[model samples]
Structures are given as structure tokens and as C-alpha cells.
Target: MKGNSSSLRVSLRLLSAGLVSEEVIKDDTKLVGGSGLSLCDSNDNSKKSETNKALRNHQVLLAAHLEEAAELAAMIQGLSWALKLVVKSIQFFCDDDSIILDYVTDKVAPPNESIVVAKLLKQLALLQTSLTSCQTLPLQRSDDDINSSSLIKLARDAIASQTTWHTNTEEYETCPDCYAHVSPRHKLEVRSGYFHPICFTCIRD
Candidate 1:
């Protein structure tokens, strides 16, 4: 749900007064056999509300072959989703320079041949319609920052737990992406072999 600009600003001010900081998080995982992706908001401490998904099958194949520009498209998709949850206009931080550059400059669209890129463009267009303001910036990872290390560990743990692909016959698992209980009908199995039980609403959007 996108918040009104005035209300969002006020809320941020209130939160800031209490020393409660919020950051929009975008992180990608390149594993041995597959990739794990997460887009979320980090509240103070290690607590996070995130949407985690894995790439598999055709999506994994497409991601594997994506050039730098195409990869940026994928990251944009994640960032768009994260922006929807924010009440206040905020800066988006990611490790990818190409994405930040394109977002900041409003660069040219990605090539038509990449289906994933097309989807990302569509998502961004929708996000623009709903958002009042947003800024994209780069995030540098450092080993010295305890907070950064903890976030990395938290993302790794989520990926580790949700990486396996499961079928409808399998037990129900809560989707990290939407934070909803997923039943078999809405479960999606990735080609990399991890079972991500996503809700229908998330899969659709």
C-alpha cells in the first residue's frame, strides 16, 4: 500500500523522533546452483519484513544469461515492490551501480528481446503511477559494519530455509515474500530445485 505523501512525511518524522529508522533493502544471491532474491524494509535491530523469492527453471536460465543492463531491470523489479510498502518517500539503496544510474537519470528502456526486462519496465511504470517521490542510490557492502553483516546473515538464513522447491503435496510454508501462509495451489517450484510457496496475489503482481 502506498501512503500519501503528507502522511508519510509525518510518520517518518514521528519515527525519527523515537529513533526508529527504516531502510529499503535490495539484495541478490548468487549460489552454486541457483540465485536467491530478497526485497524488504529493515527496521532497527535484526527484524525485517521481507519478500523473498528464488529464480528457477526458465527464469533462472534467463537470469544466468542476462547482461548487466538486463540484471539491472530485475533489480528494479525488486525495488518497485519494496517501494510499495513505504509510507514515506525514501531513498532506495542497492549494490548495483547500473540500476542506480538508470533510476537517477531516467535512462533509456531495456531492449525488447528480453522478456524479463519487459516485465520490469511494466512494473516500473505502474510504480511511477502510484509513487509520489523516490530516489535511488548505491550501497557499498563492508565487513566492518556489524549491522550490514547481520542483514547479510538474515538474508542468507531466509534463502537457506526457503530455497528448496516444493510441490502442492508438500507441507504448507509461509511465504517470506508476502508474509502469507501459502497453500499447495499457490506454490511455485523453481528449476534450481527450491520450493517457494508464494501466494497468488504476489505471483500475480
Candidate 2:
């Protein structure tokens, strides 16, 4: 469930106050210590009682949020099917170069997610070719996976193929025109399909 900004802010504050793991209080039992309601008295035990109950609710909320975060991280790292679903949401990032670099990399990929991972890597490499140098980055976050559906694409893509012995062709692979090495590899993308994949630099040149 999505939380409003105020809910999040309030939750963070309560968590900071060290009350996150407490169970939520049931609304049935409140302090009935005072007889005649009079605002003039400082010992309004009902008010203090109310405050305590509210605090517990906040604690339960914060604990739920933290649990969600841990669950997401675990799911992203553990399951391969979920990781595959993650690829659609993910994007690659390069340095501050004023260009949109996109390319295909069928380049003799493996059987598993490695093929998809290769596509992703090839795309990034294609992008980097446009600039002097750049780094490949994954924008999708593995910070929320309680449902285990959030980062499944990434997990699947991460394990497309098993890691094994490699030649310079596989590890420090790059376009023949430019010897620029790919930083983030093992993850490729095979989306939109391509006839002949070309690195961005090669295309521009």
C-alpha cells in the first residue's frame, strides 16, 4: 500500500524515537480515569493515554515499512524469475554526455538470462561509445520486494547464464573500432530486436 508524505514523515519520526517494533494498540481500551471532563486540569490522564496509543500505532506502521524494504532486497537477490521481470523497469545510465545512446548486442550470448543480460550490457556499451568514457548503472531499485514482484526482472536478467571461463572476447568485450571496455557486463538485453547491433560511438563515427 502506498503511504502519503505525511504518513511517511510521521513514521520516520516515530522510528527515530525508537518505537518501531511495538504492536499497535487496540482502540477498545482507553483511560477512563477522569470523571467530569474539565479542560482546566493538567492531569488529564486520558490525553496521556491517548498519546501512548497513537505512538504504538506509529510503531507498527514503521516496522511494516522496514520489513517491506528488507523483503524487496532479499527477493531481488534470491529469485531468478523475479529478476527477469525487473529488466523491463531497469535502465542504464552513462556520464554527462549530451547524447542518447541505444544499440543491440546479439554478440554470441549464452542460453540463460545471460542473453538478456548481454543485451542490457550491449545497450550500455553502445551508449558509452558516444562519449569519451562512461559507466553503466541500473536505475531500478531493489528496496521494496515484499510481493517479490518488484525486481524479478533484474534477478532473472542477472542469472540468464551461469558464470564460467571466458576469453578477452567475453570479459573486456568491446566494439572492434574502439577498444573501450564495458564496465557492467554479464547482463544483456534482447529487447525490440535488432538486425545488426552497433555501439553508439561506431554509429556516430
Cα RMSD of all models vs. native, in order, equals 13.0, 28.2
Cα deviation at 148, candidate 2, in Å, is 4.5
Best by TM-score: 1
lDDT against true structure, model 1: 0.40
Best by lDDT: 1
* Model 1 weakest 10-residue run by lDDT: 13-22
TM-score of every prediction relative to native: 0.42, 0.15
Quote the lDDT for 60 in model 2. Answer: 24
TM-score of decoy 1? 0.42
lDDT of 2 by residue, 165-202 (tens): 24556543332234343322522433232111224555
Which pairs of residues have clashing backbones in candidate 1? Answer: 51-177, 57-191, 163-194, 164-194, 164-195, 165-194, 165-195, 166-195
Scored by CA lDDT, what does every candidate get? 0.40, 0.24
Number of clashing residue pairs in every model? 8, 30
Off by over 4 Å in 1: 1-61, 64-86, 108-112, 140-151, 164-205
